[model samples]
Target: MKIHNSRLISALFAIAFGAMQTVSAAAETVRSLDDLAFLEGHWRGGEDFVFEETWNGAEGGVMTGMARGVSSGELKVLEYIVVSAEEDAVVMRFKHFRRDFSTWEDGGPIILMLTDAKENDVTFSADPPSETVKSIRYFKTGENTLQADIVLVEDGEEGGFTLVFDRAD
Candidate 1:
């Protein structure tokens, strides 16, 4: 009976290990910015508040983009963003600006490192790891539609928001 029980335990352990391997394999690390070429173009969203983004195609291992938001016919926010391949990971760095062109960050750009990618979906984590904003994900839902999900982690609490974008070009 003791031997039988030990064999059953070993079999269960093997099965659990195999399942873990499968899960890990599904989250492949991002290799290049080429896979993200679909993101290039002008995209717009929001109704009461207008949001727009324009992304340049990848070139020289980098892709540059800009975003703007307007409310009540007044420019509210602006952002400059870039994606670049650095070693084994793709890094997304962005900086925010006010309508008056004043910078939001004092020191450096906010950095987010690619963590996992599959098909048209990609995930990025805060570069220095933040307690407030943890990760962000972009998903291509249709030929001309993109969705962004931002994950927030603060005070041991988790929260997030999603933004849907439609191709303007």
Candidate 2:
């Protein structure tokens, strides 16, 4: 009976330690658009295709931006983006459109909440969690370079792509 009690106590301690670790590992939510100031300015990059993004300075608790992807001198995609400070957290909402201005999403813009923030980097995840795009991250690699990562889930599999942009002339 004593040996059984000792084993049970050990298991309980392990569980408790794990719970504490999880809480510590969780990322803190960012509350201000100022934390993402590194993303400001015009950037352009791509391999076979060229893409450009321009971000305006934050004003009135909000920031606005747009991106255009071009291939062979033809516009392939256009994106409108807005980042705003909410009551509890900063949120980013964006929509994709074709050259003709047809929206990609059917219902509304995709909304992501600021989940993790660090110096020169920030990440946003779908608030309600979507089956499509899971998270978006932007980080500065150098004084003139920024990288954007988009993580997505499809058919029970997860994949992502990274776009590296450099300050445009």
Top candidate, metric lDDT: 2
Scanning candidate 1 in windows of ten residues, the lowest lDDT window is 23-32
Report the lDDT tens digits of candidate 1 across residue range 1-169: 9999999999999999999988787545436897677778999999988889899999998999999989999988899999999876888998889977889778788788877777888888996676557888888999889998988876878898887899999
Q: After superposition, how far is residue 92 of candidate 1 from its true place, in Å?
A: 0.7
- In angstroms, give how far residue 98 of model 1 lies from its true place: 0.6
Off by over 4 Å in 2: 1-30
Give each model's whole-structure lDDT.
Answer: 0.86, 0.89
Q: Return model 1's CA RMSD, one decimal.
A: 6.4
Q: Residue by residue across 1-169, what tens digits does model 2's lDDT show?
A: 9999999999999999999888766534335888889888999999789989999989998999999999988989999999999887888989999988999888889899988888899999996677678899999999899999999888968898999999995
Task: Score candidate 2 by TM-score against the native.
Answer: 0.80
lDDT of 2 at 77: 93
Error of 1 at 66 (Å): 0.5
Determine which window of 10 residues in candidate 2 has minimal summed lDDT. 22-31
* Model 1, backbone clash pairs (residues 3+ apart or across chains), number: 0
